[model samples]
Target: MAATFNGRLFLKNTAYLTSTGFKVILAYSRTTNFFYAYYVLRTLTAMICEGSINCLALAYVADNVLERQRTSAFGILSGIATAAFVCGTLAARFLSTALTFQVAALVSMLAAVYMRIFLEESLPNGENLTQPILKSGQDDHCQDGDLSRKAPVLKKIPSIQDIIGLLKSRVTFSQAAVVAFFNSLAEGGMQASIMYYLKARFHFSKNHYADLMLLLGIAGMASQLVFMPLLAPHVAEEKLLAIGLLGGIADALLYSVAWSNWVPYATTIFAVFIVCVPPCLRSIASKQVGPTEQGKAQGCISGIISFANIISPLIFSPLTALFLSEDAPFHFPGFSILCIGFVTMIAFFQSVLMRGPPPVSSHKISCNSLVA
Candidate 1:
């Protein structure tokens, strides 16, 4: 929908979620019975309002930023996200549960309000550069040049055909998609099983989790904001991607063999580089399509990550559980994490084989601008 219409236009509506979030928070404070229901409602609301918000944001960057500067632009965006994560984690440590919720809700609302006021449209004058031409009699719902009867709502949304078309368009795009899938698979697996493994092995509590996350966030923020912007100018995105994947492999493998509690914490030094992988992938992908196709391209990649997020736990969670159980054939508590390292290794190998995407010409950049 953002590819066909406009992404920036929809971002302001995410503020609506802040109101619903507060309702859930209030429900939590008052009654336990309705809290889950409210939280579920909020989740559903997120699906409606902000399901593709991150993709849309990436698409906007692809549209406005020049190709030469895109990797750094993406790195900066990621850095901001990491910085926010660090602040949020630190804030949660000191605040009461309710106060944390209140602060979070207000911050979300304020961010959305700011976007509404100041955000510029990447797709100029509501002209969607990427909209497909409709064949005559292709759809009864589409009326040419009729503002009142443009098309059905479903036609605005991307379909399986859209992703397939994108994948077939560029071989680099396809390769990047494969790399993204395995990387996200490892990430989703980590989310499902890593903390439990730490808890079982080291008797780690919530504070320990907070501390580990803080260390990762701080280091990752510096790498994205500081290291990537500097390195992206000097090296190719494919190389950066390969380096980041190596970091992922190192982080996972180090954790798998953690001899003591300090070893897991020490692994943060390697984990910091893992955060750079997505930005490098996104930078490469943005070059595969024309200016008009940013939303479709980014959306397709985001869909791959979403699909991986859905299925990874199904594959790894049980594996982790089985390995941790006393009745298992293997004695390694870190076996599942080692499996995640192997998954990262797969992505790293793919990245090593990948080459740099062809650079966009300065002439094309100016002429093919999303602006009319």
Candidate 2:
């Protein structure tokens, strides 16, 4: 809610400030003769606010949902978010930026109200949510601590040592973390450049971008809702991860080299497979640890993704700006995008090294049923 409110205010302020010729000096780079000012201010106003929610939501699903059913649950979650994105994009097409943001703020406020009123706490009465940070078998010595009692206050904020311990303890966890980092890096780099590339190459307007996103959202929704549930149970998550990475690599390559407007639309075929990546990775990561460790595991994955978000723009944005400029040394305008595809290939190779978790069995009988 705060993000939405702040975003709306920022948009309004930016318009007013720009119209009034107001600019703040962020930096004066001597090498490029660049005046990096207003854009930096604009970026600061729009913060990444979804990290905590994503971590908490995935952790909750991991804790409560049956292991065998987690992929479908996560897929459904992704589908719902995609549907919401479609709706939001469509709405934004017709609405002014300020009004659109205002509406978003209002929607977020309502969502907060609803969650507060209806959402139930997932943790059990005696379970200390904070205790799991240290109790998740990451450290053999930590396990010696009393499980019946709450964790020490210091344990709530996980130390660097705790994270290092997790990374060292589980090979699967480490592999999943690598897959997530490179996957997110590729995604972020693509997002940072794609819109600008489209606008520069095809002279795309807002409606054109909206149409593209709509198609992607529909493809993603179909894959998550229909294909994922059917395929996840039968296919190994590791193989699915590899397939998704391969699809992403192709998608990025296609976008980078697209000569005609229709080529971008054609890449929607790859979206179906690409959308499967996150759920597969999440399912694999979730299986790497016991129930007590779900939060920590998912939190680590989310943290890696956040780091990718930071690193991606730094690497891709300047590359994109350089390649798109008339002063570019190379004639290939798609060089930056090709780099993104290559980054995705790195992730594909990482996925290739992963061993799938053993198949789960649902045929075992409970003790009460065995007695009967």
Candidate 3:
């Protein structure tokens, strides 16, 4: 349904990013002082674009998934994404040296064609474009998360301003942006640096680490399917987020303590935490925005995440190199992770304490305010 659309869109875009990044790097035959930086920026730019597009996919689904089933729906969506990730990793391991970027691009293009031809639109005519659909409790044809059918068919594309206006909606957009920023900051550091740490510490080969990641992905998928659906319905979103923060902090600390190969076993539990949090973040945001706004909401929130991913590595790469040197200050990154845990705990408390926004002045605040 909607989850399928979102998952497919995200995966296809990721594949596109992979191929495009390689193409760019290959075209630049002459390596310069800025070559590595240029490569990093280009690769990240493609990833950010993919992340932004995912928001639109998320928005398509939020309106359709019932409160009771949303958690399970998200789980299924995540499962598809992880499975695709494993496949892509395996494909890259085997075919990267043999196949050119053009071949990868061709495969993606064919997949896109199949989706365009066979996949049904979830939303048609944008008939449900208006707000208040959530309030009305309509079960309209919400599968596939395509509300495009509900919208008018314009002969011309929208202007940049029109798109910006969609992103500028204050209520859900602002909060989504903030949450995305935090989530990405945490993930970029956790994922990128951990692999480096494992390789440096345990004399592990890149291939071995990839295998480890594959196993972690499988475990993560299982944990999400078992836990998220069952807990998301009963637990308050803020509390769920708080608990996840604690889990992530514990995961980071646990990694710092990984003295031997046995340490990765503990690391797997932390991987489960990483896999489970994003959906919770999405579900909370989905509940706030209506169906029509889902695209903009997902885009903006994801944009924030993209922004974080873009910046954090730039800031931390040097720190990791400088402080977490081969000999000295090995514990700085671990301490930094501990600080993230503390900051997140405080933020979660504030979120819970606030629960909802302040009461509006009837004459002052416009009724259009969605978050309020």
Candidate 4:
């Protein structure tokens, strides 16, 4: 069943690419450099939209799948993503000379074709499609007995306040938000600074950076496939987050000392595990809610992640400047990542202590569903 869904998604992806490719081709010969820049911006915006749309997809899936199996299903999706990233990174590293961006364009074209020819809607039939209010209020109670039915007038898009209100109710969101904040802080800084670090410390070129990313991608896939699912059910989400934070911190702490040739290779391997943890935590977080709430839940989480992305870069820039010496071989991004890990670890522990176990079911969720 999961395979079929994946095939359909591939088809959809292909179809989108094919159509976009033709449009890009037509524009390429006719457009100026400024037009190309606009095109790039447009493309990036579409990518952001696609990411938001996936949150909806996860919500839809949660609605259809039973709770017992949802975690494994999410694992399957993560595994597939892991594999794709590995293939993409390896291709980028080795075949990039031959497989330019044009190759990616071609793949997209193929996916578009497949989607147009074969894809069908996966959303379950005969379910309430209406949007509902997430806030706690008697006035928000349903008119009819069908809670699955959406509110008569849906908000076209989620508002900042609406998203914030949702976060206030979910323990999972609170914890995940903290982890995301630090992880992304570390990541955004690391990404922004790594090339500089490499140039100064090891005199790495573009090719070497590509090679490193390819290796990291390999480790990411391995951890997603072999480690995450195996470890997930055994430990609660909070513990997994702590472990992930610790691993990331460990990588950072080692970075200053790992100047040897072999250290990069070894740390890159560990980085995969560090990188893979967030999605695992996400899978578990989404699972805590009922299917009816998955879409809203994911949207709320996405908002938090976006908030973190915005905050991380700003916070890291000054810190990096303050701590990193002009001539120092190693910089502060590693230490910053370590700090983020420690902060997240503390947050996770505090969250665990404050929230005990999640309630068997929230009164709000139970009552609202009943009214709907």
Candidate 5:
């Protein structure tokens, strides 16, 4: 809804402030039931907000950035998020849990306040940020002018048909969506399977997971921040996407057959290349969309990713558990991880074949009008 009608900057900042405030309140809540209640409220609020700060920020990038630099900009944004993971891990290591949560909330609140005060709306000049964008379609069922005028109204929610229409409207958009799905599937499956596989094989603990995460996070940050921008224009995002998928395949393969405890940690360097997948995929998606519908297009891509994330655990978790147990099955402990690699392999091939001419947005019909 914020994507279609409201000011994205304002909505994102407000959502951040509200969510962080809820986290702060939850941190201080006295009752056990209230803790769960706080979480439930937060989830509901998230649903209402339609998307996260990350997706909204991506939409903002699509709005403000030029085509040639979009991929690099997305890489920078991704790098910052990776840096957050590194920072969060370090903070949790040093700070007490209560202090950490409070500090995180304070930082979030200040950032939100700062954005709300200073950030300009990602709308064209003269477009009111606080006002909703609406179009009055003629009512077919009403013949009277007054009734026709009264019945015409646009909904402020995303529609399934519009998303389908957008996908159908451009082959590139659809290809980008598929790339997002498979890449997310591979990443989510790896994340779900690797920890348990390591725990079973090498007897790793929470600290080991933290160390692994730190390595992955730092690698991702450096590659996206330092290397990606330099490579984006020359290589192009499509080639970058293929490169990331290839890296994912290699990472998964290594994890599946890891010989020693150090193998997993040492191989975390693969994240430096793997992190290119998302930014490149999103950069490709943004180019398939027009300036006005950047958020809507990004929303569709995000929905695909969210759906893949939901399905990934369902597919990989059972596979991991079954292979790890002493059940009558194959002896390969990293079978699930190998399957994850196959997922990336599929994405890699698809990305290699992912070719489309640039979308002609100037004459493109608006998909939102069909269902908005």
Candidate 6:
């Protein structure tokens, strides 16, 4: 809600600035200067807010949904977000920029209110009440007087140590983080490069970008809703992740070497599989940790993705700028995107190395029979 309000304010201020002749200078021709400082600051702030919400939401889903069904649950979440993107873009095309932002702010506020009213807390009050008592007892036993100072600190915000410990304790969790990090790294490059590429290469206007995004969102929603659920029960999450990464590699390559305008549209076929990557990785990561650690596990994954978002632009933006420039570096203009594909390839190999979770149903069945 805060992010939406802030975003609305930013858009309003930008409009005001433009109207008053203090126009924001954007370098359309260059990739290096694609992000203005104002935009970057706004993006970082928004990311911080949204990232927290996303982590919490994923954690809630993980806590509520069974292990076997988590991929589909995450996929549904992704699908809803994708659907909103499509709807929001289509709606924005008709509304004025100011009106669009206002609508966004209002929608965010409404969603918050709805959640507050309708969404039940996944963690029971008893569990939360017991945790502090356990912690306090442990702290009290550790030292005689240290409990006073340590108790206050512990009662405050939760520490990130548990989240960090996942990387050291679980091989699957670490592998999932690697896949998520590189996947996000490659995706971040695409986010930064693709729009500029489309505009420069195809003379794509606002409408064109909207149309493309709408199509991609539709494809993504279909993949998340239909394909992921259908495959999750039969195929291992690791295999699904590997398949998604492979598709991402192909998608990136297709975009990089796109000669004609139609090529970008054609790559939506690959989006069917590519969109399954994150949910698959999330399932794998969630499976590696205990039920109690879902929040911490998802938080760690979110942090890795956030870190990738920060780093990808630093690495890919310069490469994109250099290759797109008239300097005699290389003939291929799509070199940066091809590099993105290679990055995705690296993630694919990492996914390949991940050991699948052992079959749990057989053990469950055996235990049930023995109990009977």
In terms of TM-score, the best-performing candidate is 5
List the candidates' TM-scores in order.
Answer: 0.85, 0.76, 0.69, 0.73, 0.87, 0.77
Better of 2 and 3 by lDDT: 2
Which residue segments of model 1 deviate by more than 4 Å?
11-30, 49-51, 124-155, 362-372
How far off is residue 212 in model 5, in Å?
Answer: 0.7
Q: Rank the candidates by TM-score, best first.
A: 5, 1, 6, 2, 4, 3
Model 6 Cα lDDT, one tens digit per residue, 25-117 = 221221345446546645655644546566666666776777788888888888888888889988988987556655665665556556656
Candidate 1 residue 172 Cα shift, in angstroms, is: 0.6
Off by over 4 Å in 3: 1-48, 93-96, 99-107, 124-176, 326-333, 336-372
Question: Candidates' lDDT values, in order?
Answer: 0.76, 0.70, 0.55, 0.55, 0.77, 0.69
Each model's total of backbone clashes: 0, 0, 17, 10, 0, 0
**What tens-digit string does per-residue lDDT give for candidate 3 at 314-361?**
655554555457655555534444444554454345444424222222
Top candidate by lDDT: 5
lDDT string for model 2 (1-372, tens) is 111112222322333333222122312221222234444544543343335465556666765677677788888888888989989988988887556755665665555556556665554222212222234222222223333333222224456787776777567778889989999999999998899999999999888888999999999999998988898888877888899899999998888889999999999999999998999888878776544566567778888998998899999998998999998998888899899999989889988998965444322223222122
Q: By TM-score, how accurate is candidate 1?
A: 0.85
Backbone clash tally for model 5? 0
Displacement of the residue 8 alpha carbon in candidate 2, Å: 28
Taking every candidate in turn, the Cα RMSD to the unseen true structure, in Å, is 6.1, 9.8, 8.1, 6.0, 6.0, 9.7
